[model samples]
Target: MAEKVLMKGNEAIAEAAIAAGCRHYFGYPITPQTEIAAYMAKRMPKIGGVFLQAESEVSAVNMVIGAASAGVRVMTSSSSPGISLKSEGLSYMAGCDLPALIVNVQRGGPGLGGIQPSQSDYFQATRGGGHGDYHMLVLAPNSVQEMAQLTIQGFALAEKYRMPCMLLADGTMGQMMEPVELPDSAPEMAEKPWALTGTGLSRKHNIINSLSLTPDELERWNIDRYARYAKVEADEVMYEEYLTEDADVCVVGYGIAARVARNAVNAARAKGIKAGMFRPITLWPFPKAALNKLATTCRAFISVELSMGQLIEDVELAIRCSRPVTLCNRTGGMIPSPEQVLASIEEAAAKLN
Candidate 1:
């Protein structure tokens, strides 16, 4: 049996990235996620890995782009605003078809809102924060264990798709401690013939760039990238369904909000409300087909989130408006309590009768 160690979510992500054969980490410090940088700084030197705290978030992400272009497992972490700073670099990586891991341990924000946890970055993450027709694989971890597990998975997925992956966590998950079993060995990485390694006078040199002055060429690149995204959408949708077999009302959430919604699901059950919980593990390439299928049986959905009705939009779209969806949320660093979510579920139930 694998031994379990107690770790905070941020620390778990750092350790897991190292275990996943990530030898390069470049990031700037920010509230709610600085522990990730601190952990990497302490461990990387001993293992012959590189951990450089860049001067700014912009520089950190561009550093990731450089490492990723050379075909290495690289990662960077920050909070909401820091992620926004990295958005252009993210688009560049996507345009260049380079793979790397980006972590966002979210804090409140449109503009440095607060240092407390918030999921308001849903639109930012899933919609590709930068100006481009591209997408990043976004994984939301609900617990410290998932934090570690998803970090490893994010690296693998990024490499496989040749694009960026974001681990979308919030402050509560970043600071919370739990027992977690980490992997003992790193997974084998795929060869990157497309990487810009020096030719050494043996073959043609590889070039990595996102610029295409020709309109037709740029259009083709966008179309091709989206084709890859279509494959990802088809194959990589991950979600969790709980007590949904006979549910009339479904509670939808992700990350920290999902954790609270699970408790509310149990409470709603006790109160004779057929409420189940649907947690989206992947925010992008969302489990639309699964939710649409559930809409056939479930009469309504309650989207519980730490943002003001952001996740509810996706819920309604997923169900194709076949069923009504309500939002139960708190924004600006406040979390919705289990009782609050349960009240929303009860309200949905009452309306169904």
Candidate 2:
């Protein structure tokens, strides 16, 4: 039987990670996402799991890497600045093909930006945040309920693909409370044949390192990783559309921005404006197909975001620039109100007409 619980999005993620068989967690506390670490600290040891607060984000992610290399389900989480610090570990994890879950409850960016919720990391998560040509599976959850679901799904996908899966969220979603039906504890997965556990008599010693001395070897590694990414792009894209059928305008958004956009769509509908929403759940393997289809029907697209035009560019690319994509956004900790969204929709509709 499933249990309904009222939980903050960050708390739900911590609980869901435990239910998903993640017994190892390492993280540093950062704004708007600190509840996740706090929840883990309280709940992890009670379940006989280990939760460690490392000295810094770099060490925290490296700890996750160490745990994952030992074949344990491991996770780490942070906001934007902390994630920036962890990018070195992220790149190394990618190179080693380590299965880990790293949640970035995104906030404003560049430097020691504000603690307010922001989706400014779209480029960072989609295009490799760190150096080197590698990708992380980036999942964006628009609601607290989705925060739980995607965190569990993220672990499974990471293990299956031997890659890091990131749950990219923002402050609004992280701090908001919502009802969620928790998933049951997943069955213990069988041993991974490819994991870097001690190699016995059957094979040679396994070493996990990102450094490649030769240029040819490095180039070949890049090609191989990209091939894996291409497969993910084909199989892993996820999104949601509301009132898209017969709509003249589509609002593109994800994370909390999607929820606000939905409210605006509802307001637009009440006024007889054919406005709809197209939300990309997997921000990295973006929902290009759905957006392209909407382009054929919708006269214009409005991108609602917590940052200025980060996701708007992707919408433009997906639609092949056949239609204009307008930006409706707030930055530096400000959230766009439903009224603002409604106004944006009205403006877009007028422009299209």
Best by TM-score: 1
lDDT (Cα atoms) of all candidates against the true structure: 0.94, 0.90
TM-score of candidate 1 to 2 decimals: 0.98
lDDT of 2: 0.90
Pairs of colliding residues, candidate 2: none
**Model 1 per-residue lDDT tens digits across residues 1-353:** 54999999999999999999999999999999999999999999999999999999999999999999999999999999999999999999999999999999999988989999999999999998998899999999999999999999999999999999999999999999999999988877878999988888999989899999899999999999999999999999999999998999999999999989999999999988899999999999899999999999999999999988788888999999999899999988899999999999999999999
Candidate 1 runs further than 4 Å off: none
**In candidate 2, what residue range of length 10 has the lowest lDDT sum?**
187-196
RMSD to native for every prediction? 1.1, 1.5
Q: What C-alpha lDDT, on a 0 to 100 scale, does residue 273 get in candidate 2?
A: 97
Q: What is the TM-score of each candidate against the true structure?
A: 0.98, 0.96
